[model samples]
Target: MPRERELILGGQRSGKSRRAEQRAADWLALDPAHRAVLIATATAHDEEMRERIARHRADRAQRVPGLVTVEEAVRLGPALARHSEPGTLVLIDCLTLWLTNLLMPAESGSASPALAETAHAGLLHALHGARGPVLLVSNEIGLGVIPMGREARAFVDALGRLNQAVAGACDRVTLMAAGLPLRLKEPG
Candidate 1:
């Protein structure tokens, strides 16, 4: 059977991550040996972020006890390749943060376009050929008003493109609003 690939998109606090976790749990429940892995991309660069990460960990432990976590802030393609296997489910907590990490300026104060492109290509390739169920979560930033800053605008554009590419690769695509999921794409 072909693997299931899903993309969950939503605004902040719209329950995208929660939805992904629920789907992962459901997939894991199908078989005793089915394993769930969360590929977390968020970094604890601030106290608030650290707290948020901690809360997520606690929630996952309580809500999805069997799910394991893998922290991959940049090299998501390699991580996915290593974890995605038959009878395993991988949930990428987010793609927006991962894009941000790729776009961040180096000490020279310039973003490397080649590096970002390569990483993006690698991730898409991995997702397209994954051997197990994969759930990817990403913020829907295109609905908002235009940003004034150039960097912010670039980030938004990159995220929009990334989401579109992932959605194309996914067998299912869902938009979350008010904790409700509206299916955009259904598996054939």
Candidate 2:
């Protein structure tokens, strides 16, 4: 069992993902030969999102010179389970999108609780069973007013629950804001 599980959470534009990436890069710097596993959760749903994803990819390339990025829009647990190993640092960029993907409908149908439950179980299993460092980035959506719709409320509720579940299993947890890290949990 490798000792590496971290969580970073913050509001939008809070530089949470950047902070997570920087920490991952720093960890890799200590051991240059360690494999860099970047699990991207963003989906290219629209032109704006596609551009944002593209920019994020470019930034990752520039920041971490030799990074391996794996784009898994929905099934992240399987991907993480497959690539996680000793001497590897897996950095997952934004769990919010992944949660959305897991909770949202494929076409126009209603969001299925059974599917979300399965995805949640898979993610937790992967995180707890990982063999190397796993840094997960996610948004803190509970800082705002109550949502105006049932779906939005359900999504927020699910995300908050998921964040808590991951954080509970992490060795260290940090909240980023304006590119600064506020340590929530630190290794003993």
Candidate 3:
């Protein structure tokens, strides 16, 4: 399947995306023919998010000049499958937002429960079957206080399960905090 798969877990502003970008840049630097593509899962619903995405776009462009990007929110499995090439590195900016989209869709009744389950399975299958390298970024939000709302609690639990499954599928797993990485798992 994948040449290498890495899962980067962290909180907000914890440098997970930066590390993924750096990995992409390094991969591109290794060979002239090497390529990198970032699949962004975020949808800018508000002005603040729009600015944040724009800032990330500009910063990533400056940091990794040879990198390309593709925006995919729900259909990430097919997108990943399309981008996974032997000479390329595919990076998924964040899985948290993707989960949110599938679970609590912004468009009310757009995403059904069965659809979310199918999409989640598809994503894991794609990761396992990738031909090139894959870098996944996800938030670690279960460490904080318990949320009062049932929906909030369900989201946290779902994310935890999703993270666990992704981590198990990955070749390496790292926890990021204060821009530092603590390696959790690595292939021997």
- State the C-alpha lDDT per candidate: 0.90, 0.86, 0.92
How many times do residue backbones clash in model 1?
0
lDDT of 3 by residue, 1-188 (tens): 23899999999999898899999999999999999999999998889999999999999999999999999989999999999989999999899999998988887855466777798899999999999999999999999999999888988988899999999999899999999999999986
What is the TM-score ranking, best to worst?
Answer: 3, 1, 2
| Cα TM-score per model | 0.96, 0.94, 0.96
The candidate with the higher TM-score, 2 or 3, is 3
For model 1, how does the per-residue alpha-carbon lDDT over 98-181 read when each residue is reduced to its tens digit?
887788843346777678889999999999889998999999999989999998898888889999999999999999999999
lDDT of 2 by residue, 88-161 (tens): 88888879988887778555556677887898889899999998999999999999999999889989999999
Once superposed on the true structure, which residue ranges of model 3 sit more than 4 Å away at CA?
A: 109-111
State the weakest 10-residue window (summed lDDT) of model 2.
Answer: 103-112
Clashing pairs in 3: none
Query: What's the residue-level lDDT of 28 in candidate 2?
Result: 76
Candidate 2 vs 3: which has more lDDT: 3
